[model samples]
Target: MNKKTGTAREAPFDLAAEFEGARLAARLFGGESAGSYLVAGRLIRFDRLPVGDLGLLTVGFRITDRPREKWTRRFNQFKYGQPSAVRAATRTLCAAFGMFRLDGDPRVVVVSSVPSGQNVVRNDTPASKLASALAGSRGWEWLPHHVTKDRHPSLTGIASAADRDATVDGKYLAAPIGGEPGLVIVVDDFCTRGATFTDIARAIRESNPGWEIQPVSLAKTERAAYWKGELTNAHIPDYLDAAWRGDPAVASPFF
Candidate 1:
């Protein structure tokens, strides 16, 4: 009787279970299990520092209505920005740092490049407002960075002359300003090309030299492409099984 198999001759491989085991494997590695991994299909920890008072600088993007504009008028009234969602996501990210007892009292900085002109750092767009509001609710201070130039996909530099991708244009302009030291986390509503973070990393590494930049998102199209490995039954279970075998490396938490 193979213990890994069931007797019904119809037992399906539990994906959620496999995922959990992998997560446990991550924990065993002394990795700081972030709450962001709770719903994320893939999780990766980029840096581990040994010190006090960590800072999390989040490069943010605007979240817009989905399902195309033709259908937008039907639900525009109910499609306003929701602060609850922003706070929940923020807490999830914060929890990840909290899990490993790394640093809880973090100073979060929200940097935006949505072209809202004016120095409305404290009171500009919804995203900035949400970030400010989060800081207020958590009793943590918020730092806002907003830029407003004639920059977008339609601009001259940053992207290809023939490039029609709006997202890429936004990223190109945003990267220069967002790249900074002290545990930076770049977040977007979704990622299609993975260029924004890459550019940010390039800028930061060029300027600061050794700072590690982590890229995070609310929703990604597929885990396999961005992550190191492909998503498969073998990948998850193999790691988990190796973890349960008391691998020394697995036991070493991220430091």
Candidate 2:
């Protein structure tokens, strides 16, 4: 979970022990909160709030100024694009999700955002591809983006002048199609404003509103800002608050 660099250096602690603790936290809190805390502590930067031995954890990236380039580069390597740092992180995330067993040979349909025009090598090896590959062991069906090529707002709408149009155009590609509704999970490399996930979720909802679409990713870009000591407690609401305030320069494809 070393952040100075993108390396997911395994901590000396036992993963099973950590998983048990996280499970306990979720049971008491009603969802994946405990697992979220455990993940934030080891992989991403975040703090926890104690409730006896158990506690609520909030991500730490909301208040910090860590650079995204570091993460992007590291993630790039993890995708079979470089040194494979992403594989290590993916394993950690999967373990945290208790997603070890597959119900059947999963027919995986992976939907990825092009982010740039045409199919390039980098996009081919993007985070979605990496996750698809990793999950392939369990019979995943990687479905590519369903929409036409276009630039759409990230769930968080704030876009810098430096943000490239190619990046935006490639996003529409990730939208889930109406016909393929059996997808159990949707993976985005990162989520900040959550616009992308929301769009994909909306598309899924429109096609088959009942489908379960759990958004999973390696890092929450916002987590780098607020992570602090072990005793700090922030809620999911905080992240959503920021999402609501995000800009509209980045338009939603659904809009």
Candidate 3:
């Protein structure tokens, strides 16, 4: 308690505790499940699973509400080589990967795909850059341009999953053998219908049948209708309370 204000002092943010609370709330309210998910229609297996049950592994930064002005700005900053944004993005990756116990390993390869012939000087491939940084931090190998997009598919404009899948040319998308056989984590910035990731994972697996493949992203659209209900809102205070306590679980993953 603060003597001057005669009220209890607020505690610092606790990441782990907040995460646990969020997990509990999700369980109670029938929200997003925690842990990695097998890519639909793919038989590739992983020796280690990530912390989400969705079709792909993801680190939830925030609810991806459409017209997310803040997220847009941060993504732009990260794309344009802003130091603070890079650090924050890197931290998020570290946190998610760490939670899945993926750090300090040589058996994992982080791969990112970009449009072929894209100008690297103009920072056109932001996801690749982010994936490379994450790999370096984890002491893992990074293939920034493992797969190449033959044509510029406007993924954002494509509404249907089938259309998105049709746009991806598997013949043009290629993943080379990286000398070592291990799990390959395909990293991307955003996931909508997951068509792009699915195509990439398929291409990699077809090329290297011995390697395990999985797709991970920083943010994924919340497609579950249950997330829109009042239960999510009701648990906000609990998450906030856990955050204020500075629980180790709530601590920043970058630290």
Clash pairs, model 1 backbone: 29-252, 29-253, 30-253, 30-254, 34-96
Candidates in order, TM-scores: namely 0.38, 0.46, 0.58
lDDT by residue for model 1 (1-255), tens: 467765332233233353455467567765544222232222232221111111122212122323332212212222244554443344333332221211333333444323223323335444454344444443443445532224334232534422433433334323233433444444433333445445444444554554444444433333343344333222122222233233454332321
Error of 1 at 11 (Å): 29
State the lDDT of candidate 2 residue by residue for 120-155, as single tens digits. Answer: 224354555545654554455555545334444443
Off by over 4 Å in 1: 1-143, 146-150, 154-181, 222-255
- By lDDT, the better pick of 1 and 2 is 2
Error at 247, model 3, angstroms: 15
Ranking by TM-score: 3, 2, 1
Better of 2 and 3 by lDDT: 3
Top lDDT prediction, candidate number: 3
- The lDDT of model 2 is 0.42
- Backbone clash count, each prediction separately: 5, 34, 13
lDDT for model 1:
0.35
Worst 10 residues of 3 by lDDT: 38-47
